[model samples]
Target: MDQNSEVRLEDAGDGAYEIVGTRSGDRLGRVALTGERVTVEVVPAARRRGVATAALREVSRLTLRDRERLELLIPWDNPIALRVALAAGYTREGIRRGTPELLVYSRLASDSGEPAPRLLPDLPGGELSDGVITLRPLGEGDVDFYTELHSVPDVVATSVPAEPKPADEIRRRCSRAATQWLTGSRADLVIVDTATGLPAGEIDLYYQEPPLAQAMIGYSTLPAYRKRGLTTRAAQLLALWVFAETDIVRLVAGALPTNIGSQRVLEKAGFTREAYQRQRLPGPDGGRLDDVQYVLLAGDLLAQASGAGTSHA
Candidate 1:
């Protein structure tokens, strides 16, 4: 059977086209074409080979034969599909809302088209490991490590007012965090132990007000990783990065009045204790709790780095 003849491309109206590929009486895959866009769906058992690509190449040749733009939509959680789309020349064009789980990718039909938006930044230079711990960007792949860390008895006993979340819930949170990072709204990093290379904690800075260049910083350390000053070290490095690379002017943090560990971490990073809001937070067991607010001005960071100031925390 001729390979081209084995696959049938049919025009499905409204920018949808269909490709049916068969092998030994089994339907191997199907490709949908619409306008200049093609959606390739292949059997799970027949994946990892060039089957989808072969189909896509044929579809691209047919569609772009007249148009100059092509696009595809894939679930944001499907890394394999994402790789295939990127390899096939699709650049992510942000994500579509109300879809819950899909991402859109597109490319210009011309050879001189712009590259895809960057999803991550280059790792910054820093004293990553001071003989015990290392720090790096928190990636989507760290979901498992993060979930396990936060689920530990001691960790749950300290933070996370609610019970240990189900794995699916943790996965959803990770997905949302990745989306936030991709859209340039948040910057997060992980603290790792040199001996195990596992994420022992995390530090994140999220924009509070884009126009005002204000952000909020948060950090948490796993029970096993506590007492080594890891959170303090990681917070300092992240704070430095934000001040140097972004226009952020003020950083804010909040801690339960009893969370001395977190308070210490903030103070060590040059933040000043701002106010204590009475019953401003919820307790781990569900009651209201008092919280202390902290503020770190960009000038304070520069002053501390230049050895010209002292923290008032």
Candidate 2:
């Protein structure tokens, strides 16, 4: 539990777990356990300081010590609660079909107290470098370069979906990239040329559902930065990191049938073409597009002659 001496969970009788500050004796929050569900409420004054995460973890420990499972059903719009729930090591099962507004999460005695295996964990310092190309978490600062890349013909043909995203929408996506990393939804990273220290491209790891041991990757290189093998290097670095740092055993990517250049990039990175999936991706004009899937297994990556590289951050 966090904030140990700063705050403590006091059992004020009648099943009420009051979170009180040790210093000022102020009521910070409360953890209520009803049936199999666990709920936490934090006062506005004491928010965002790890109090809620600590309380929820303590409650889960106390409950799981006796039973097998602990549960949390936070509202769909409550991002703060969701963060706390995740920090406290809850697994997001799914949203209830009958109650779509609620996002369901649960903790079990058998579950390791780490972040859910399905959620992508943040990289330390959010960077990876091989002394040449550097990969760092994409941020709002990359909006200009990100928008520029989307304008390239090859990028548009290969990565852009049927309907192009508007400028405002692209900016919004760039802004939310970091938050997505924190939430473990995705890892959006900008590829930087080490010599020039300029944003050269972008890559992302999209977490697949269910068997959390699988993930997919996507990439786009700026027109000015292509033909230098940076995309291939980024893919290799990311695959190495995933295999070394995460349980994801299979990393995959896809490209259009005609995008032989992209296919070759994946090939150079040691990803094997697995299938010619017909109409696997959404297309423009309400149709579907075929994709050639490429895959790299964990054993394949781990057995490679190289390493996950280093972080220059």
Candidate 3:
């Protein structure tokens, strides 16, 4: 069949069908019938199981019961099909070796007595945050607070590249943050001072992949709002929300070695110094500089929160 061959089986009967052959709701695949032929498509992370064969068997039954001829087109060089098709009652009709090679397979649906496969539930979003800071979705109004926070002189001084950015540049950064949040690569929130009804700063939780569930944490505070423990309070609140709301397990933060103030904020927020890397970060003035890494695991935050409660009285 050509690329435009709408070989989807929906028009044949109930519009759509699915076959799930594994417990994880993974190892699942589907087949769509277009006119008289069946097109097989595999689901990711669920491949290699018998999902394809099971789906084909179900489709074959449907075709045979409907008294329609069954046709399937396989790539000429696909070795996997050479084994699966023969085992599943399919026979090689002929081969068309053109610009794009095609190997056609056919099967007879005589009895049409095969049992249909079952479907599975959708994957859950996993654990939501713990309720401390409330890791909610970012909105357009957050741009103003983010812009003002990043423009603060102290924040600029402590940033990887020490130079303060212009208002336009800060706005551009906020715009990018908004895009990232919308795309699901990042989650951001305005740090609202619950008591004052004003935005104090911003917090971002970025998913860094390959490890399944990890994230990087970053925050900034406005100049007039520093030294009053707002950042620390916000961080603590945010950390609680992150652990409770998201599926993330590890949160990492990086800072210049000389920035004791930043380090203190992190420590106060219950993060632990994990490691130090020399010349790993760039200096604000110029050249390369050393950096210290801090990490706060979900367990650590839970422990700290419990400890703080005990000491409060």
Candidate 4:
């Protein structure tokens, strides 16, 4: 059915639903809202087309009208439910720690007029891109790609997670990308070459504590994509997205003191060299390593975009 179709909840004994068409009531898939904690599920066929979002908003509106507050305790790993909850105006309060971590989201009847504000907003359309490259959140399918990326000697020497990560660990990180984004932990994105549509490299934005006013950038390009400036462009794209969508005031990045190429990429991406901090990064060995830090402010990006700033970063 089209997005405009008028679908309403029907009483099938409880708060259960079959994704039926609005006009003639032909079916699509089933949707159910079971008791108390407000959990929702829509079968695969009828998913991601606003079905779950609609169900959640309706449920919250009705339930909160009766009670003072409505709360949802979502499994930390369940990305879809988390999205639907936030979309339906639920505010993420915190996490409930236990055997399986449960994210706590709540909506109040008093929270009216304006829409709910999310601390960590979901990536729009599940990806970001420029004409030359694209960035999509890491997933389990990227396990193999990440393993190969880490195996590259040059990449291993320069980037964080300094040495190669075991395949199992890579798989776990990929699987947790969604949950991490939902919790404002980190955003790990796989870079793709637009022309060939193959995975080119990886870039990530690591958010800081509490206010989230600061973040750091890290990226690496595959051996095949090097010398082509793909890493710089990807960094620029990420910086722009953060400045546009977030309230972050500063974006920081650091490179090993000897890695001139890595430093160049950040500079070309509009970051200014701030300082060199001794023993700032964890070494591949048990020792600590020096880092050359770079900083980029929101206004710096704006000046560059408007052509009012000098070319030098």
Candidate 5:
């Protein structure tokens, strides 16, 4: 079958075009041109193929010839869509908050007319595992567990505000976590008990830039899962992922001096104490709190691997 002939575009008026696959007689999707932004969508059935990419290429060729900039807003949770955009040569520029959330990707009309250099890395797939615990990407199924995690008094007091959060807000954060992976801005991993396959906690890494050469790490464990060495194991796996998967130079974390638990977790994860800042963070009690900083470097991980006489495999 001639795929090119099967895929057709129709002017939908108002600067919009309808994409249809003639062979299937399915309205695959639509594209809308508004100012410098170009939005494209493919029917669910046609997704993950070359449909969207082909449509985007045609759009770029015809519509973007005289355009200096073309932008695509992809929901952070929509990794498939982000992949399509990336394949069609879009560079993630920044993040924005809204319903469903979004990462802004754009391409510039350059003198050479070539695609932009890929600024975002492919989303981490599969799972990172240590001997005792495994860390995987958070998903919608984790909403209830995540909510329960935040509801713990100690967790609320140390991580988020002391006040109760609406259910909607918790859900929004869960969705954002899924999208953060695609945006290359953050990776929130659900720490699972390897023996039971249940969520024990979560760990997060937030990148500072597209280079993703440095990041800040954070974590929380469920009340029932604490003190079993789960969080420490999870942190180690995350540190290993950062050092092995990306170009990260260092991973950093901060804790209130009063939160001895977090400090110990960082230490156990091989993060060296970096600094102590006075009144660095706001406390729940409306007072300033001292912050203790910790860091783990790629070199440190390598040294540890060498000391153990094992490859960092």
Candidate 6:
């Protein structure tokens, strides 16, 4: 159908629709409304050509006529559908907890003039330690220390994709960590050796938006701290912190199978190997490496705490 063709909507019964291309007399897509929620699906060829957008506008118009609100539930992974909804004047309201990320969008019929509240809640703060090691949030004063930690060869090899950067890039990353925390996207902590109170490494827990009770964790240790089990202790403490403070039910970690040291650290922290993906990660030198995935459930932590007769659970 030509772009200027007159698109028409026909009743397909029971709040269903058929968007037809007038010029070529072809069915472009479908739109359905059930209990104030509108969902649109366009043919592969008709996508991005304003088909979904046109249908969504019609839906909104109908909702307004009925003195009701317009809503759409779009998956986080489906950016195309989200774009169409936003283009049609729908504001993201919140997330409906389901698999991964199910974003809910709404626009009140009485007031569509302003944007909805879009920022996530700020993360809670605290310190976690196990006498030998501690895990704490990174601060402005930690930029230099974080930079030096990334400069360590062993640390760079395992975490970052490229060679170690100077202080400026590290500063940017540390600053981004602040933003991520404020937006509830991640929780980044500095691993400390309590004996000397020096930074031994760092650990990260990613994925903070709702409908996602699982987070992925990553860690790096400095050369000087290798073989000392400080990272292991820090990870264990982090697990405790995450479970106690947040609603996260599962924590995951990935390590290069060849990196026995990291595997050992996860194991010591009560994580169990779950999957082995062949050539799943890109190597630093443009090669592929196998990824060994590990996971720790909330129940696992509780069981461990009970076994040790500790009050962490």
TM-scores of all predicted structures: 0.62, 0.73, 0.52, 0.80, 0.83, 0.59
Total residue pair clashes for candidate 5: 1
Please identify model 5 stretches exceeding 4 Å from their true place: 1-27, 75-77, 93-103, 111-125, 160-164, 209-212, 308-313
For all candidates in order, the CA lDDT equals 0.69, 0.80, 0.61, 0.78, 0.77, 0.74
Clash statistics: count for each candidate? 5, 0, 11, 0, 1, 0
Per residue, candidate 5 scores C-alpha lDDT tens digits across 1-313 of: 2355557777899878888887776899998899988988888888777787777766766776787888888875677777777667777788778775678888776523344333234436688776678888888788899899888888887774456668987787787775667666788889999999999988988887546577888888888788888888877777777777777787899988788888988877778999999977777778777789999998887676667543120
Tell me the lDDT of model 1 at 34: 60
Ranking 1 against 6 by TM-score, winner: 1
Point to the candidate with the largest TM-score.
Answer: 5
Whichever of 4 and 5 has more TM-score, that candidate is 5
Query: Tens digit of lDDT per residue, candidate 1, span 11-82?
Result: 666655454554445566777756655678888876887566656656666666578878887775665666
Candidate maximizing lDDT: 2
In model 5, the Cα lDDT at residue 286 comes to: 83
Tens digits of per-residue lDDT, candidate 6, 1-313, equal: 2355466677898988898887777999888888888889888988778878877776676667776687888764465676677667777678799665577877777755332332323334457777878787776678878887887777777764636776766765675565455435677888888899998888887874457688888988778887887887777777776777677788899998778978888887789999999988777879877899999987887787778553211
Flag regions of model 4 displaced more than 4 Å. Answer: 1-5, 10-36, 66-68, 98-100, 113-115, 118-130, 157-161, 209-212, 305-313
Model 3 lDDT tens row, 60-137: 765677664676777633535543554456665676678665667677666333332111111124122233223333
State the RMSD for candidate 5: 3.9
Question: Per-residue CA lDDT of candidate 4, range 94-179, in tens?
Answer: 88899776889888888761345554566678788877889988887888888889889988877664777777677778877887
Model 6 pairs in collision: none
Which 10-residue window in model 5 sums to the lowest lDDT? Answer: 111-120
Q: Rank all candidate structures by their lDDT, best first, as comma-separated numbers.
A: 2, 4, 5, 6, 1, 3
Q: Arrange candidates by TM-score, descending.
A: 5, 4, 2, 1, 6, 3
The Cα error of candidate 6 at residue 199, in Å, is 1.4
